[model samples]
Target chain A: MSLETPLHRVEGLGSSHSGVSHFWRERVSGAALIPLGIWFAVSILGLAGGHYVSVLTFFSRPLNGILMAAFVVISLYHLVLGLQMVIDDYVHSPGGKVVLMLAARAFALACGALSLYALLEIARVF
Target chain B: MADNPQRPGHRPRPLSPHLMHYRPTPTMISSITHRITGVGLGLGMAVLAWWLFAAARGPEPFALFLSLAITPLGQVILFGFAWALSYHLLAGIRHLVWDLGYGFDPRSANRWSLVIFTLSFLAPAGLFVLAYTGNGGYYL
Candidate 1:
């Protein structure tokens, strides 16, 4: 009997922590990744055919290690956020949506952890 | 909705345009590609972590990584990642620009999308060349 539109009924419902903070985070993380990602890509190209020692040397450098770790963390953060949006779009079931969302978060966290760990271990000589 | 009793035959309301309903444009394609690449790069993150894992494990494992990377399939994956990253970066920057309230015109939007697509392929190809052949054969 309610005249309220569906959007009116659901507005600020269903995981509304606040206004578009999820969106804002995506943009901020994405913006940061532009520089970090570019640096990582070009550096990898520099090492492209390089010997094992050269890679090891690359890892050993303080700046390279720091930047690689930063890039990995931010990239994964951006990725999971993007995945969340995609899942929200296509997944209709509430349970399925939550499952997919959790899976995305787990995937990103694992990847980031391993990346950071590897960066640390590879640069152990420093 | 199909279940709504107010409808005589219980038919669903006509939905908005689905994929097949409308003519596709550069803007549309670019948008879908951006999302696809975004997910694709999620998978790429695993590869990135795997690479760092290999690198951290020392020379033997690192050599294994290099060997695999030099394979044809591995090259394809690497090149795909390169292109994906490039496209996503450009598209992401475009989003940022749009957020700032620029480039909303259809002509400029379409043009930027084409430019993004073009650079995505070109940058990766160029980088791949520079990496494999440009600097005296691959790596050190």
Candidate 2:
């Protein structure tokens, strides 16, 4: 028989199967944040001189609402992944690391929910 | 050959490098700041989540939240959060440009990094001023 084995056998059987890809994913998220971040900044800046009602109206626009929702989701996802890396690096205790990661995920999810709710409210107001 | 460094009984010990011996570069510092802002953003999101939930709850909770936010400590935290958000956002953009096979040159990278640093603080400060004063009162 040849020395080479089946691809599945070489792929590894456990959680470590896709570990390398996770690092690349974190970088990819980081890259995405750049334009998203600038867009958010410019959008907020445009609202600077407006009143509360005007600000509300701006978000009330369908496109604006959609963009805002996208921003919220993307920002939270990036934040969670970034925070997870931080926890993994510093929280050496296994239990503490797991707890911290879970907490980070929960916080991100809460932010996402609140942002979506706020966007929906804006849509209703319009 | 018998003279080889590899020995049957003696396992080679890995050499650990000293951090102090390494030279730091702009890329290294940028990477570090990216991480710092990331953590800041996480904490900032917690504060923001609280604000959103409070606002959704009712006027009373919002008023309570507003009161807390107007305090000196609250303002500082908010200001810091704003900067953190801006920095992370700008830095993320820089990374995106680099990833797209653009702005990879040393000069352009440094220039963009400087722009990100300046805009991060400037955008947030401008927003705070508008938010603070445009509400007709000192705090909003």
Candidate 3:
């Protein structure tokens, strides 16, 4: 029933689109989260009732500091992507949707930066 | 603009067959809860950011943070978050498996959902038991 040639039909259907990258990044970040989340849960449970010094000492470890930073950055990025999808699906007004999306990105970035700064201080970066 | 038999002065408004249109099933409930929990966890991150800010501020502020964390209301919030975290973690894993094109059949999907629902509670309960037994000194 179609009249188009194979080459014509194939035009513009390629990997140049943004959707593929977004899909992969989301999945990759999710895969990264499993182990990182486990580590974080156990570590936080261990530090739950500790004083500042005790918590600081645990984070002061080189590997712990690095992994904590990675967790904050990656998780925040993933969070923003997930939130953006929800907003796009639910928000009908174009102007309101854009504003909400931008606000989400801003909030995630701010939180990620603050978390990194705090981790650095804990690890005595200064 | 013209009157119709069904409505003398107006036309029937277009209505979406929304939530009520579909019969509720386990998978439906699980999917909806997934979105709700995602939003809840996002809000919980704000509390976490506050904790980190206080911790970085030094011992006095951190102590103040702990004081607030242990209040009756604080404990409620903490335990709520723990439950949320457990449920979200299990649900997330279920989603990841689905992403790989597995568990689409109704029987397996329902079974997995039931398993997730049970384990969500058990995970947090186990943690509490450990803390109470003095094995999880972190909770003290």
Which candidate number would show the highest TM-score if scored against the true structure?
A: 1
Give the runs in model 2 whose Cα sits over 4 Å from its true position. A1-4, A8-16, A42-61, A121-126, B1-25, B100-115, B129-140
lDDT per residue as tens, model 3, A37-88? 7787777777766567777777778887798888777778778777877997
lDDT of 1 by residue, B1-140 (tens): 23444567776666666777889999999999999999999999898888888878877877887888899999999999999999999999999999999999999999999999999999999998777676623334
Q: For candidate 1 chain A, which ten residues in a row score worst on lDDT?
A: A10-19
Candidate 3 CA-lDDT value: 0.77
Please give each candidate's TM-score.
0.88, 0.69, 0.86
lDDT of 1: 0.86
- The fraction of reference A/B contacts recovered in model 1 reads 0.67
lDDT of each: 0.86, 0.71, 0.77
- Model 1 stretches astray by more than 4 angstroms: A1-15, B1-13, B136-140
- Candidate 3 fnat reads 0.36
Q: 2 or 3, which is superior by TM-score?
A: 3
Better of 1 and 2 by TM-score: 1
Error of 2 at A109 (Å): 2.1
Clashing pairs in 3: none
lDDT of 3 by residue, B51-75 (tens): 7777787888888889998898987
lDDT digits (tens) for residues B1-140 of candidate 2: 22346656888755555445568656666778889988888777667566545544556766687687778998898788779888877787677667679988777777777777888899888878766676422211
Provide C-alpha RMSD values for all models, in order. Answer: 4.3, 6.4, 4.0
